[model samples]
Target: MISKIIVSVLYFAVVFYLGYKGWQNTRKASDYMLAGRRMNPFVMAMSYGATFISTSAIIGFGGAAGLFGFSLLWLTVANVFIGIFLAMTVFGRRTRRMGLCLNCHTFPELLGRRFDSSFIQGFSGLIIFLFIPVYAAAVLIGISRMLEVSLNIPYDWALIGMTAILAVYVVTGGLKAVMYTDAFQGGIMMVMMIILLYYTYSALGGVTSAHQTLTDMAAMMPEKLQKGGMLGWTQGAKFGTPLWLVIYTTIIYGVGIGVLAQPQLAVRFMTVKSDKQLNRAVLFGGIFIPLMTGVAFIVGALSNAVFTARGGKIAIAQAGGNIDKIIPTYIEQVMPDWFAGLFLLGMFAAAMSTLSSQYHVGGTSLGRDVIERGLFKRVGTSAKASQIGVTVTILATLVWAWVLPESIIARATAFFFGLCAASFLPVYLLGLYWKGITKVAAKVSMVGGFAGSMLWLLFVHEKEAAGLGICQWLTGQPTLVSAATKGSWVWLLQWVDPNVVALPISFLLAVGVSLMTKPMRQEHLEQCWANF
Candidate 1:
């Protein structure tokens, strides 16, 4: 116990010290928000990767690997090539040039400037305010689950403690503090994950034994998993999920293409000073994000062998049979006390790093995008306005965190990612690459995607269907012919991943609307296009 407390104290001191130094360097709002717009490529890369892949990936996705088997490995591949490679090559340089050209600081501001529409800025800010908290709450739940497993703390206190600490550094120092702390935390995560991989492998005897054990276990999966085509990547049914319409949705579009639309990630492009810096950052991010995520998935799958050999038990009972607790449970049981402390701190680092970025992005969207342009122009440049925006954002997120409902961490995280991809990606990509995109089209696309995603979640998503008693009510009514004849309503709603539906809807709406409205002037087109 003394050892654990000592380790915790040392970790807190290091983080607070770095945050203090970052606060000292912050003099202007630009520095607080964008690191003075002169961050080095390596720091920016590590910070970006750290913010993107947090406890949600390590614990939440790791739990997914245990339950779904190796099929989910495709996401890591997509994340590397699409999220890193395509983002840098296709969007990075253009975004940096456009942002600098218009003096845009936040993503909503960037879109508002690109198309010459204050409506786009205000609408985009509203979407961020509504959806980002869901994602932030998911991150909070993931870290809280780990703490509950490792330290035997109640989940509510764990959530409160983690949220409070993250809020402090983010509110005090903003982006400069977030980047510097992310770099420091990123180092700890890399080292600790490597050690975890080593220890996890050794615990099961060796790699060969681990693979054999997993292969044996795969043969004994329950009918529910097998029927859903989740047995393995190669052997499952090709189409139509059993209960939920197991469409090819998991691999083709779910998480694979969704990374392109992440708002927290989009803002990173504005922080670097030049396109060359972005190029350099991509190379580093390409290697780091995949390595960390890939290793976590590998370790999570391998843990099944250890659990099976002990008693065929994969999860602890007190945590409500959640697969998300598997990685944390394994760490506490297998690793030494001191190393477990390091592991716990790494988990906290992952949570805090991602949380800080979310808060910073959401705050900027409120401050610069909505308030400054919408209703508070007279007080826009005042320090009080910025502080008020930040304070309100923090309070709103806190309310969402406090009232969060119980759900699997990965599904919740993916839901918000889907929301962002659906609502923002279409407009953002078009604004950067296509000069023909008009202000009216941009607004239509954003609103359409937002409505489509919400409808899907409310009426179609399994969790929502189950929670709202919709499925039960439908099943009870004999006159409801579809529910009686067809087993359940889960299939009707399970055709395509939300991103697949949302992206195309947003794109087509934008195109259709732009054609109907008058096009932008040739002079305006040439000015925006020349930068690329």
Candidate 2:
């Protein structure tokens, strides 16, 4: 406890000093919003990776791995290939060029300018500002729960305290502080993950022995989970079953593809100066991302074997059925005291790195996109207004952190990521490459996608619909899908993620509507592609 307190205090001291440095350097709106478009490639890559892989990836989804087992590593593959490599090379280069050409600082601003529609910007901003709090809450819950377990701090206190610390730097120094601290935090996370993996394997004897032990425990899977089609920690789930659907659709497909359209992440592309920087970022990100998600998932799954060896219990049983608690409880019970302290600091880094970016993106979305550009032409870019927006975002996140159910971290994170994909991916992708995409099509696709995702969540998807209870309240059924006969295709639709359904709808809407509508003026199209 004393060592934990001392390390925590020292960590805060460095964090505050970095925040102060960022504040000292931030002299203009550009510095606050885009870090003056001169951020280092290493910092940019680390910031992007850290923000992308947060406590949600480490604890929330790590805990999910504890439940679902090694199948979740598919997400790590997608995250590395799609999220980092392709995203940086294919999307980042163009986004940076286009943003520079148009002098756009924010993701929404880039789309709005590309389409020449302030409404698109405002609407995108509104969606981000509203839904990002939920995602932020997921990260908040992750670290807070870790604190609750490792330090004996109250969850509420940890949540509030972490939020307060992030708010000071992010609100004052903006992107500069967020990215600066994110790089530092990312390093901490990587080192801790390496240590975690080493210790885990060492505890279980060796890599081959550990995996063999896990494989041998296949039949020992809980009867309930077996009924739900779970195989074991080593073996994947039975295909085409409920457990399989949840693992593949929600955890893998939803978040894997959803990373493409993240608003907070998209903005990071615009913070660098040249394509060379983006290229370097891709290399760094490729190496860094696996350490974050891959290690977390491996350790999470292996915790089952560790627990079984120690106490004849699986990881989930040890965590008392709350998947969110599995990783934290494992750390508390298994890891050394000093390592737990350091790991807590790493979790704090993960949470703060991600939360800071989320808050910055959410705040800027409202302040720069909605208020300044959408509602009033006279109100120029104001950091003060952005600070106010950050405060509001923080409050909303806190409420969600308080009210959101236990084991909701992974689901909420997926919800926001999938929502972002449905709402933004079509327009953002098409607007970058295709000259024929019309403003009206972009508007329609975004709104249509958002509506489709929400409607499905409320009516069709079993997990979210049942959780929200709106469908039950209105129609006396947990979900509209509940009315379907079991074993039918309609019944199976409940397991499909919103991304699987809505992304295609959004893409078709964008393409179909663009073909029918008049294209943007040739001059505007030329201007948007100026850097290309």
Candidate 3:
């Protein structure tokens, strides 16, 4: 017990120390919000990679790997190629250049300035305000779960403690604190993950034995999992899942394409000082992200073998047969107390890193994007106003922390990622590359994506509706439509992937509106589209 307390206190102290150092560096609102537009590539890379992966990747997705076999590795690949590489090479340079030119601090400000519309800023802020809480809650739940498992603390106390610490640092120090602390925490995570992976494999008697044990365990699969297209890795077809579903839903579609539009991630580009920094960060981030995410997934799958050999279960006992707890359960059983404490700290670091970024991004959206543009613009751009914005943001996030729901961490994370992808990626991408994209087009696209995605997820998507508790209560049956749920046209459209539906809706709306409205002037177009 003393050891746990010591480890926990030491971890908190290190984070707070880093936060203090970052706080010392802040002299202006820009420094507090965007690291004064000057950050080293290595720090930027570690911050981005750490913020991107998080407890969601370690615990939530690790739990997924244990449940879903090796299918989750595809997400790591996406995180590297798409999230890191494509984002840095494709969007990073233009965003940094344009952001600098426009003197923009937040993503909504960039979009608003580029398109010449305060509406875009307001709309972008609205989306962030609505969706980010779900993501924040997801991270909070993940941290609480690990604390509950590792320190044997009550879940609510763990949640409150973690949330308070994160909020205090973020509220006091802003993005500088976030990035510096992320660098420190990211290091802990990388080292801890590597050690845990090595120890877990060693405990299982090495690679060959682990694979053989896993194969034998597959042979003893439960009747229920065998029905859900989860026939382990070897016997794929017996579970009624086609190759298309396996590749699309599990690999290509579910996580592979999902990383591109993560709002928490996209804002990182705006925080850097230059294209050169983004370029350098990309290489470091590419290598680091894959290593962290890949190791976590590999460890998760290998845990199945160890758990089965030890007569332990590999399925998720929570979330109604969902497979998200495999890693947490495995960690509790396999790791010794000391290493377990380190692993738990690493997990906490993961959760806190991501949660801090989410809250920062969300607060910026609410304070800078929404409130500043609409009602608070009259107050002027004084440091006092920025401070007030910061205070409001911290209070708003605290309310969310208090009211977060249970067992929705994974879904909530996925939902926000999807929302960002659907609403912002199309317009944001086009605004950078396509000179023909007029302000009208950008506004329409933003509205279309935001409204369309929300409507689809709320009313149409059976999975989302069911997860949100809207389906069962309305229909009296869990499915999309039923005899009891007669006016359910929205649920019927839920079959369409939001990316497929909303991306095109946003693109077409942007283009169609842009073409119909006045074309962008040559000078304006050249100014915005000059870099590429």
Q: Quick one: how many clashes does candidate 1 have?
A: 2
Query: TM-score for model 3?
Result: 0.90
State TM-scores per candidate: 0.91, 0.99, 0.90
**Which residues of candidate 2, in runs, are more than 4 Å off?**
375-378
Clashing pairs in 2: none
Using TM-score as the measure, what is the rank order of every candidate, best first?
2, 1, 3
Give the poorly placed runs of model 3, Cα more than 4 Å off: 233-247, 250-255, 317-324, 374-376, 379-406, 469-496, 529-532
Give a tens-digit lDDT track for model 1, residues 259-352: 7777678778888988888889777777787667887887777666676676756433312467678778777766777788888888888988
Off by over 4 Å in 1: 232-238, 242-252, 315-320, 375-386, 469-492
Candidates arranged by lDDT, highest first:
2, 1, 3
**Candidate 3 lDDT score at position 199:** 86
lDDT of each: 0.73, 0.91, 0.72
Q: List clash counts for every candidate, in order.
A: 2, 0, 2
**Candidate 2 local Cα displacement, residue 331, angstroms:** 1.1
Which 10 consecutive residues of model 2 have the lowest summed lDDT? 374-383
Clashing pairs in 1: 241-245, 241-246
